[model samples]
Target: MSELPHNWVKTPLTNIASVEMGQSPDSRFYNLNGDGLPFFQGKAEFQTVYPEIRKWCSEPTKVVERGDILLSIRAPVGPTNIAPEKSCIGRGLAGIRSETGISQAYLYYFFKNIEPWLSEQGTGSTFAAVSGQFIREINCPVAPTSEQARIVAKLEELLSELDAGVAELKAAQIKLTQYRQSLLKAAVEGSLTADWRTKHKPAETGAQLLERILQERRARWEAKQLAKFADQGKAPPKDWQKKYPEPLEPDTTDLPELPHGWVWASVDQLSESVRNGLSKTPNTDQRGFPIFKINAVRPMIVNFLAIKHIEIDKSEASDCWVEVGDVLATRYNGSVDLLGVFAMVKDVPVRTLYPDKIIRMKPVTGAGLGKWMEVCGNVGLSRKHLVARVKTTAGQTGISGEDLKKTPIPLPSVEEQKYALAILEDRLQSILELELPLEMAFKQSTAQRQNILRAAFSGQLVLQNPDDEPASILLERIRAERAAKLELKKPSSRKAKVSV
Candidate 1:
């Protein structure tokens, strides 16, 4: 509505077009093969040109003819496409018919630029709705007919190239992600860094060290149990203590042959303590204590900005507050792929995770280190074992502490464990450094596409033609035709006053 270029004008969409909102045909009328009329539903891609069509309805209600632009008005908005064939659309869409006043291509590009503004004006609580009146009221920038065609041609030229680059970047990212997983699988299977380990022979073996740690952990647990009994002034349940296995050995049949002297043992045998986070009311205010949840646990680095807020009581403050070297494991998820994904809390300086979704484990014996244990736990050997134990259902998948306690792990000697961890860290850190630039490159490609769109819509992309016919003449013709149609729609004066 404000100032424009030399030949440009501002106008309300209502003056330039007729709007038709789409409605869904009754489900009972839908047929698979009866006189095929293609049905259009709003999707992320261009709606009309796509090869796949899922729904069809015989009883027509909201019809869209060829060349009309169809825009999604609910759920996800702003996806607009020109219809290529006669079709019925669902309640989720709206069709715009240019009243011959504006070029179809010109209106398409105009909507692309102003879609964000239109979305802002949309009113609804759960899902946004853009009514016919809402679309008509939207303001648009106008140019001469010939100038609009020139702009469209220029935009198509640059946008096509940007789209190609984005597709290539996406493919590269997928390959890089696959490579990372392959690298981890190789490391766990004794394929990566095997030559280095073979060159050095330790006098002590991993199996012997694992067995000694299990014994030491059992002794500590027994001592703690005896102390609890004395404090309560009562006798402990001897049968209850005897029923559970104290230092459960790993099932060797589940794994391939390991490097010599590497022993398999259950995860619980080496644990000093296994605990979950505290559940408390969270404060949404940014200034309050920062808390973390299942989503904050990234693959390599912790995403600090993903933190939430939680208000905790002073009495229970000491119980769930996170310290460095605590391992966070997800106990519940819909997919087994995410069931037991673990994140190590290293050098954390904030209060986090006053919730039960994240399970924390600490080593009971001094024989094992946290970093080495984290690497072993995350590698393919442990992850596969954990996933196999998930209880499956219709829509639910879960893993419990008892299931975690039974996970078989290949344990190495303390000295070898330190060396193995160092090697793994060196390789993973190098991969992370390589990954960052690729991620940035992919992001930059998308930003460039948006920039091209911005330039094309702003009249800066193409030259304006002075000799071509102006849009003002076309508008006058469109207006006259519409007035004639409206006159035809008018009832005779004799019948105008009658009520139903």
Candidate 2:
């Protein structure tokens, strides 16, 4: 921070700009009809360079002219945007207008360079924010007027190219993601294994497998019921088996016809138990049993590290404990990307309990339906079903447990399920390998962007013009003008008081 070029001087932001902190008006004045001017609040309204207009304010309290630099001063601090037009800013933002000699483009890029610092400066018990005085006191190195223009021009040329490369990398990532989903879609729909089905026949057709699974499911329930009764020293009552509830059948209305030897089965039939996890908020003490946070369940990946330890009764922990081969569906999430997303527990690295935000489906053993069901729920029929069952509460999207249990999944016999899953894993792994370099390139480009900005600000981006006046001289002139203006506004008696 201390190494400055001979002609450059570090000046407080307020000395080179006017920082106007925003004040929100009454809620009654806000409208979605675009009544007066664009109402921008905080991070939500921001895009890469400009902001998206969502709300407008009729009786504007704080306004910023077009092209003013907008800075977020709340919870998520330090993202910057340029005002597209004359706008009303909320309390979450502060608008900055450059001084007469400084370039607005220069100031905008400077803010980008110091975003991490701005975030660190924010302080609050509930939500972090920076005071107007804090922003005013920030020190930045200003270049001479002509040199600033040169630096900005060079930066635009270089960064625009950088942005284009980043865009292509991002597009490749998206296409790869889409391709991977299509492969999974094909796998579950029986198309991926169509060739294998042609060459060989399965020992058990999907219909016969489902029938046998139901019989086994009932027998297991009956045995468990009998054991519980004996443990309580009570004899089994007559017609006890009649009390058992049957799994819901798949509704094939308007559903695509399955390939030969395949049938539709409800998730209810595939799972021995489908239930929500523990609802209690976990403690940070890292004691007792570990429970999963919502992040532990990603699409087909479980990150055991994303868990909290809680002191709960052993029985409660046992009930929510996730086991290997168990399929998990997100019950709800704040992001649309994660809602109704599914993952299977390939391995339980730790004895982890799950939260109410997750739904656990313990796949019926002896059938190789675990991986098949996991792939099924993530795409195809599950997606269509999810659209209808999605509900919003407290700004979160979620699906009900009852609806999840009835989700239809195309069933191939156990052998074919394994066959399809093997092909899927192999193909998905190839896609993942191909995606690795793109991710690394993405990170490298981001670092390169920061590097370019650093070079631009530190008297390295462009050649300095010796004819240009020093930034220090400009600051002095600004100071003198401000002093003269303040003196002019003072009372006549203050002049005599100063002379005395």
TM-scores of the candidates are 0.79, 0.95
What lDDT score goes with residue 145 in model 1? Answer: 73
Query: Model-by-model lDDT, in order?
Result: 0.69, 0.88
Predicted candidate 2 versus true structure: per-residue lDDT over 2-84, tens digit per residue: 37667888889999999989999899999999899999988898999999999999999999999999999997889999999
The numbered model that scores best in lDDT is: 2
lDDT of 1 by residue, 30-88 (tens): 87774557777675435433314566778878898887878878766766777777888
Q: How many steric overlaps does candidate 1 have? A: 3
At residue 183, what lDDT does model 2 achieve? 95
Error of 2 at 331 (Å): 0.8
